[model samples]
Target: MELRHLRYFVAVAEECHFGRAAARLHVTQSTLSTQVKALEREVGGPVFVRTSRRVELTEAGELLLVEARRTLAQADRALDVARQSVRGETGVVRIGFSGIAVLAGTLAADLHHFHRAHPRVELHVTELPPAAQVQGLRDGTLDIGYSPDNGLGDVGDLVVGRGVRTTLSIAVRHDHSLASAASVAPADLEGENLVVYAADEDDDSVLDRLGAEQRARVHRVTGTLGALVLASAGVGVAVVPAATERVGLPDIVYRPLRDMEADVEVVTLSRPDELGGPVRAFVRSWDRAGRLTQS
Candidate 1:
């Protein structure tokens, strides 16, 4: 039977009097009686037995009332959950990151804040290489990413969120000559053995910037920590975001790169037109964190 039929049955069952049930349901007594009869016919059984003095439920009526109440309650709960998801209060957001030193902690902090505010929402984080983050975002495996801007190009369908610039710094062994300098210029790295992030096919600018002479001295490392470890062991110096110092390697000293500029950008496959409340909240938190760090 339809929902209205179930509701009419419930009301009549609860009130026990056709006239009173109709009044409670804002319907006439005859209308209520006819609807209840229709419902009984649809169910293939009588729902109530009537006497001149009172009305009482049959066994079938009792069972239908119990089940009808449960069904209505479940339907209401499902609607509430769907609404929450639409409001961005409950659902899953898959976030990808690369280069732990630059965006990992900031992303973690924003996630903690978002979780506190919307505990029903699930945040899934993955650490991937810069190239992998881009691929994941494009392929719908990741909803958002945090990575250096160099990795993300003008992918027609993707949206890039507000980005913040963080200075590139030189990571050198504490005993290295350049480690003693207040700041090292690009020219200072002329003949120095340099450790760098492994190039992806999309990274032509980085490759081009380090021309033949610089490329000759370059040693590619698999990850941020590997570059730091190599620098610490005196295998070579590395150029990393200033944030890298936060990872805390005692044997490695970080010196600002006097002329280089690098930025860590937040990327998303989600459309600008479709950004939900949670995504907006996260972007705000990220912006605040960048301001705090800058100040």
Candidate 2:
């Protein structure tokens, strides 16, 4: 039967008086009596035993009352959940990120802000390469992403926004020859082996500015932290984003690269029109203009 029928049945059952139930429901006693009669026909039983002086429930009415109350409670909860979802109050937001996004603290800061504001929204974060993040966003597995992938081409209506603006730095051991230098240059790393993150883009990093000989000496590491660990062991001086200074090891000294003019940017990626309510709210939580500036 209709939920309204159950609701009317519950009101009559609770109040046990048609006049009182009508008053509680803000309906005329005649309308309340008509609706209750319709409910009895739908359920094929007499729900109430009417007496001149009193009203009491039939055995069938007692069972229907218990089930009716439970069903109404469940229906109310379902409506509340649907409302909350539509309002961006509860739902899942899947986010993907690249290594530099974490090191730059852009991902963490944005996550914290979103979580504090929408505590009921589930966050599913994965450390994906820029290519994977791009793929996920396009294929509908990810709602939002942070990566160093600048949409050079093939992005197809995906919105790319700046997530970080920082410079590259050299993380070297204390005893390394370039450690004492206040600032470094491509030329300064001429003889030393360099540690760089292996990324989806070809020339997106300091490797593009290095001379052929220094470029030849490059040791590409996949993990950002792996590059630092190797640098701590003197395998090679780590070439990392300037934000790495916050995570500097005791043996590692970071120096800014003076000649690399273009500031490195980690960009955020998302589909234009496919974002869900909670995902859209989570994306808006980021203060994009101020990302990674101090970090």
Candidate 3:
């Protein structure tokens, strides 16, 4: 009838003697016998037959024994899993990010460290735009988000933390003019057509310090990688985070943007309060790995 009754029934069924079952259960013989009798009454059957020398199980008792053992084992396992969750040793952590967030620096290394250390924690990762990531966090669909911190306007309700600091770079076709330059100065891109993010906030980001729009045409795409892909096809030169250098796109060249005083602070966002166990553990692991440096 109850888990405790099942446990008592299991102990009694295993030992087959009132005294031994009571000792195994750390209870008095009378207590064990009374509990089992109560269980038998609840089940509408007798579970045991006792003589002066032996205790034998009824057919009902045999069936209840098998089921009771299984139920108790499952209950024990359930408790173990619950405890593990509370300890942050196991559970799913939904992490949202743009493709470029984990590409270059400390944020990338932090992910590796967290994964290696908490192998049992399921890292359910998704690629989302910064606006979508912000929405996901607010809507409770995502536990953590990595996005360009620039365009997340009025995200003050989210707990934004240092993720990675990245320098700006120009992604151009291999044969495009200035691709061979060691580093391209902002002034040199005066009249060039440029690829930027779909969001106006992103368009008006740190890249605007270059004053590209005063003389250049701007094309907008939904993602940083999309901008680079267009740049590779000579659609336009893309102002991208330095991580684009590692993407290995054919016919694409990355040149550092010189005289750009501002860096893109790719940051992590979460709910404004202390997070759940798994997410908190992951954030702590990131902090412990010393990945908070602004590069």
Candidate 4:
């Protein structure tokens, strides 16, 4: 009926001796007998048949013993899962990411580090534009985000951590005349249609910065990889973070943007007061990655 009753019944069924069962359970034989008798009455049947030489399980006792072991095992597993969850060893963490911030910044490295450190933590990573990241964080959908400072930095009531700055680079088709050049000046991009990240609702944009000194019209792509692919197909020149070259996609050349120096900062954003243990652990993992980089 109860857990203790099942436990007592299991011990006695295993030992097959009243005295030994009581000793194993750290209880008196009389007490064990009374509990077992109570259990038997509740079940409306005899759980054990006793003879002078030895004790044996009746048909009801045998069936109950098998089910009882399974129930106890399940109960123990449930307790363990609860304890682990409380300790932040296992849970889900929802992370939102902007194109360059996640793929071209340290966010990608930090993700690998976090997964290695907390293998049991489930990571729900979403690739979103800076505006979406802000919205997701503002609502309860996203616990944390790796985003550029342009849109997410000045958002309401969110905690933003200082992040590394990334220099801009020009991505162009491999066969383009200037692709082999050491670096590209903003003048070179003048009159050239440029593929750029989808602009956030905020006015401050990396594309705007890169094209500030030029007359290029911006054609937007939703993600970092998409921007590069469009550039590779000669759709337009793309100004991307230098870190994007780490992927080494073919048919595109990433060259430093010279003459005009524009830098975008990638930062971590989280709910001001709603960050949970799993989310904190994820942030801590990024901190550790930063330390290792500095070291």
For TM-score, the strongest prediction is 3
Among the numbered candidates, top lDDT falls to 3
lDDT of 4 by residue, 1-295 (tens): 7899999999999999999999999999999999999999999999999998778999999999999999999999998987776666888999888777755556777778778878998999888877778888887899877776653445757777667788888889999877989999887887788876654533437655765544336676657888888898898898787777776778888899887767777777777555476777776665665531211
Model 3: runs farther than 4 Å from truth? Answer: 105-108, 198-203, 213-216, 290-295
Report the CA-based lDDT of candidate 4 relative to the real structure: 0.78
Kindly report the root-mean-square deviation of model 4 from the true structure over all alpha carbons.
4.4
Model 3 Cα lDDT, one tens digit per residue, 1-295? 7898998888877888889989998999888888988998999989888889778899988998888888999999999998887777889889888767767555566667787878899988888888888888888999988888666688778776676678888899999998889999888887888886644434466445666655337776657778888998898888888876788888999999987686677787777554577887876775675543322
Ranking by lDDT: 3, 4, 2, 1
Worst 10 residues of 3 by lDDT: 286-295
What's the lDDT for all of these models?
A: 0.71, 0.78, 0.79, 0.78
Q: If scored against the real structure, what TM-score would every candidate get?
A: 0.80, 0.83, 0.89, 0.75
The clash number for model 3 is 0
**Per-residue lDDT of 1-295 in model 2, one digit per residue for the tens?**
8998899888988888888888998999899889989989987989999987656899999999999999999999999998888778999999998778888888898888888988999999998766778788888999887876432346656877666687778898888988899898877887788887655545435566444365666777656777888898999988887787888577988888886564567787777765488977765665344431111
Model 4: per-residue Cα lDDT at residue 18: 93
Candidate 2: worst 10 consecutive residues by lDDT?
A: 286-295
Predicted structure 2: lDDT: 0.78
Better of 2 and 4 by TM-score: 2
Q: Which residue pairs in model 4 clash with each other? A: none
